[model samples]
Target: MTNRPLPRSFTHVDTWVFDLDNTLYPHHVNLWQQVDARIRDYVSAYLKVSPEEAFRIQKDYYRRYGTTMRGMMTEHGVKADDFLTYVHAIDHSPLEPNPAMGAAIAELPGRKLILTNGSRDHAREVLARLGIATQFEAVFDIIAAELEPKPALKTYRRFLDLHGVDPARAAMFEDLARNLTVPHDLGMTTVLVVPDGTKSVVREDWELEGRDAAHVDHVTDDLTGFLQRLLPKR
Candidate 1:
């Protein structure tokens, strides 16, 4: 693979979109484990089932509905608001502040937004913990997407409409390659934020596709470095 400067596709980007969780932060922190456990607990309690059963159900819902919240809402009539509030309540302390990432993002000449399947509360806590809370123009959360999770065209379409974003002038960065497909189809340049070491998408994102060559325009392990390179040489 050629080591190139920021491609022409990204040079004029007027809208920068990012996915929270493993995308903004690296995967080694395993902050997701905390949320995963919390979600399992919530599932167990809500379903009045054993932990193992809850785990099985959660995975099924994740595969079929894109999120446990969506599955629960559809089948169990669970309250999306309450579920989001509960699952995102875990301590966000695992994520330390990254002033470097903050600076890189601020240097980008565009509206910066976080498009995530997580709740606004979770996104807020994580961004504040990362010291990049103020760098974003908006955080379009799962709640804002009406509980339609990513990889779904509807959520991306909703984000475009709500933000008045021109996909042709935008670029999207995500940890999961599959999530980038819709954005690619919507005319946004797609970048995959690869995790360190041999790991990539976790088991929870069971529907994640490894087909980066088909939809992704760029791939990088260091998001800070990647963002820095996107800035025009001064």
Candidate 2:
């Protein structure tokens, strides 16, 4: 948690784009697991499959089609909005307000925005829990991206167009390093937020080396500390 100067390349950044979920709140909260189980249930009940089978297909579809929701839409004709609402219906009580994080975020010098594959409602809930809803200029969610999830080039292009953001002058922060590829290719400095103690999430072989990818600009286990370091001196 050292507070230090950021790389010189970051000095040109004027917009800060962050991913929600594990990027905003620490993964230790296990809130995502609740949504994950709900998705499994939805898939199981819809397809009449066992929960085990549903979970398998859920992950498979998630990997194949960017999101299980997208795969369900493509394969099962599931309604995107409905699926989002169902999956995100879990209790967000595990999350507590993070005023320190909110304060550190306020110290950042740029227009802030959240880019997520989640629904706006869920994003609102989480941000409210973190007590930082007003800090963001906007949230670009799945519906906002026309249901196109992240890691998808078109979604990134659409978001950039809609926000009038200059890729070269913006920075993208995400928990998944792979999600940073498009942003990095689009000329944004990418930071991977892998907060301490959540390393076990890299279950897949590819995920194992994501932080080593060329598109990954930096890795930090402490996001607030990272932001604090990047803040300009008063």
Candidate 3:
């Protein structure tokens, strides 16, 4: 959290857009670690490469393309469904329900939606584990974006068009600061959800970069606290 005053700019927001995964749940939970490992395994087996080679290729694809799956789809002709299904088949038990966060999200004004690069099934499972499945009106997922991932302008445009969300009246929350860039440029209030720096989490160096960028309007390590502060006191 910054020393600056709370974001009063959010008052005009009529649609609250949240990214799934690390944004909704604390990163310390390590749920994404399982998914990351599964993705590595998939890559190793799919390409018949060694573990080290797989790791290198996986990250290289991720860097070149917004997502590893997207890169595979483009270069190797991998089917999106096959890749998504394999990577997301991980344990969800690590994610316990957050009642306070759920309450805060349910209390937020107007429509609440999930915008995720992961599949809708993955988003639904995560939301179910968080006990906030019913809070969001809809999920705009990678499948909905025709296998394209976030940070892509066209994907964001598809979401806006499909949901009828007016960017000026919407607020977007994401764990990765870069993902908020397009939303901010489109006139939405951008909030960066960062790790609290208390625990180690598996992530790339670039994924942790760009927190102080101009596109980020607000940054918070505590999603629940941040959302709670956005609403008027009871």
The predictions' CA RMSDs to the true structure, in order, are 3.3, 4.0, 2.6
**Residue-wise C-alpha lDDT for candidate 3, range 103-127, written one tens digit per residue:** 9998999999999989999999999
- Candidate 1 to truth, TM: 0.92
Best by TM-score: 3
As for candidate 1, its clashing pairs are: none
Give TM per candidate.
0.92, 0.93, 0.95
lDDT of 2 by residue, 75-169 (tens): 99999878988999989998999887888888887899999999999999999988999899999999999998998999999999999999999
Q: In lDDT terms, which candidate is top?
A: 3
Order of candidates by lDDT, top first? Answer: 3, 2, 1
Global lDDT for candidate 3?
A: 0.91
lDDT of each: 0.87, 0.87, 0.91
For residues 76-144, what per-residue lDDT tens digits would candidate 1 score against the true structure? Answer: 999998998888888888799999999999999979999999988889999999999999999999989
